[model samples]
Target: MSQADACLRLNGVTNKNITISNNVLYCGSQLSIKATNDLTGASVYNNAVNGSISATGIQSCGTFAISNNVFINATANNFYPAAGSPLINNGANPFYQALYDYNGMSRSLATPTVGAYEYSTTNNSGCATTDNFKCGSSTASVPQYSLIS
Candidate 1:
C-alpha cells in the first residue's frame, strides 16, 4: 500500500481545521495518514511514521505546520519505539497537542516525544495496562483478546 492507503484517511470538503499529530503509525507498506482537500488548514506533525505521509489540495487559510517528527519502524504487537530509536524525545512542540499519550499517560510539558507514546524506559507497552492503546499493526484489524482475571 502507498500513501493513498494510509492508516487514517481524511477527506475534507469544507473549511475545517485538520490536525494529524502525535501518532505512531506502523503502516507496513502503506503511509501514516493521507489528507485530501483540506480547504482551511492541515497540520501534520509530531508523528512517528513507519512509512510516509501524503497531502493533496491543501488551501492556504490557516497555518499548516509540520515539524519535529521521526520516521522509523516500531516494534510489533506493542508499537513502541525501539531502543535508541529516533522517535525518542524528538517531538514537535505543536501549537496544540494531546494532553495524554496512547496509554493515557500524562505528557511532559518540558520534554515531549514524537508519536502517540511518551518515552519511558520501563513502559509496559500498554498490552496489559490502560484503556487506550496504539499497540498493533496499521494494516491489520483489531484482534480479539480474552480478558483474564
Candidate 2:
C-alpha cells in the first residue's frame, strides 16, 4: 500500500468546488485526496484518513473550511479511533449533514464526532456531572450520552 497510487486524484482542475467528507481512508504512503492547482473552493470535513492530503492553490469562499478531520496512525493496515477517544464530540456542525457515517449509522446535526464513523460510546469518566465537558481551558457543551446509541 505504500507504493500505491492516490486513492482519489484530481489533476489540473479549474473553477471547481470540491467537498470531501465522512469517509475512511487507509494508505501506507499514497495520499488520500490529491488535487492540483486552480481549485476555486473546497470543504474537507469530517473525514478519517491514515495518509496525508494535498491540495494546491485552494481558495477559501468564506464557507470553505476544513474541520473535524482525524488523521490516525495505521495499525495492521487499518485505521480506527479507539474507545474513549477524544475524537468523540469534537466535530462542529458541517455545511451539510451526510445523514449517516461511513458505517451507515445516523449522524446528528449537533455535536458530531470527528472521523468516519460516529462513536457509539461515550466517555463518562472525565465528563462533568451534567452534559458539559471540560478540558483544561476549553469547555465544550455537548449532548449527554450523544455518542451512545
Candidate 3:
C-alpha cells in the first residue's frame, strides 16, 4: 500500500516498446514512474495513480502517448469512477489492440475506458445474456444489474 521510493521507479534502464496501462497503484508516499534516464519507448497510460509521475530524458519515446491517467486521493474506499466520470470512455485504443482489462473481460474497440477496469453495460459473468436471475428462480421478470465488479 505504501513505499519509501517510487512505486514504479524506472531508473537507468534502456528498454523499448514499454507500455504501462491498466494498473491500480495505491501509493501513500511515492511517485509512480520517475524514469531518470536511459528509459525509452515508454508509454504510461490508462492507470490510476495516487501520486506523481516524472519522466525525464526519455529519448526513444518521442511519440510516446501518456494519456488517460487518473490521479486522485487514495483515501476513497473504492477506485471506480463515479457516475459521469471523465475516466469513462476517455482512453484511446492502443495500437497494440489490448483485448482485455484487468478483470479479463472484453474491451470495446471504439471507446475504451481508463483505469484497470473497463465499465461494461452488462455483467461479464459469462451467464445468460438475457437476464442474470439465479438458477431455479420463480420470477423471470426481473433484470439483473448492469454493473460488473
Candidate 4:
C-alpha cells in the first residue's frame, strides 16, 4: 500500500502476517496490493471489488485473488449479488468467516461468498439503503449533530 493520503482505509499494517479478506471494499478503480518489503503471509482473498490483486508481495503461504463485476447494484448502494452472480461461490475459505453477514443473515460456510454480505437466494428484495448506509428494512438520513459551546 502506498503511504499517501488516498481514499482507501488500511491500518495496522506490517511487513508480514496481515489479513484483508471477506470485504466489499469500494476502493475505487486504482486499488492494488503491493508488498515493498518482500512481505509474506499476506492473506488477501474472497473479495468482490473493482480493484486488482497482485501476488507481487507474497513470497509464499497466502491467498491473493480478485473477483470482478460480482455485484448487481454496487454503484446503487445495493451490494447484494444477483442469482447468477459470480460472487455466489467464488470465494476461497475465509480467514475467519462469520456466521452472519452485516445484515445478520446466516452465511454459507462450505461455499462462502465474497465480501461482507452473502448472496441470499431466499431474498430478492435487494439491499435498500438510505443516507448512503444500509439499515434493517430501511435507512436513516439527515444526521443530527450538536455544537458544544
Full-model lDDT for every candidate: 0.55, 0.51, 0.53, 0.56
Total clashes, candidate 1? 0
Choose the strongest candidate by TM-score: 4
- Residue 58, model 2, lDDT: 38
- Residue 90 lDDT, candidate 4, scale 0-100: 61
Please report the candidate that would top lDDT against the real structure. Answer: 4
Candidate 2 Cα deviation (angstroms), residue 134 = 36
Candidate 3 displacement at residue 68 in angstroms: 15
| TM, every model | 0.60, 0.52, 0.55, 0.62
lDDT score, candidate 1, position 29: 77
lDDT of 2 by residue, 1-149 (tens): 22356666677766456665555555456776576664446665555555666766433321122322232333322233455555566565756665665445667678776655566743222322222223323444444324645
Give model 4's TM-score versus the native structure: 0.62
lDDT of 3 by residue, 61-102 (tens): 222223232322224333444446555677666666566654
Q: TM-score order of candidates, best first? A: 4, 1, 3, 2
lDDT for predicted candidate 3 compared with the true structure:
0.53
Runs in model 4 with CA error above 4 Å? 1-12, 32-38, 53-56, 59-69, 122-127, 136-149
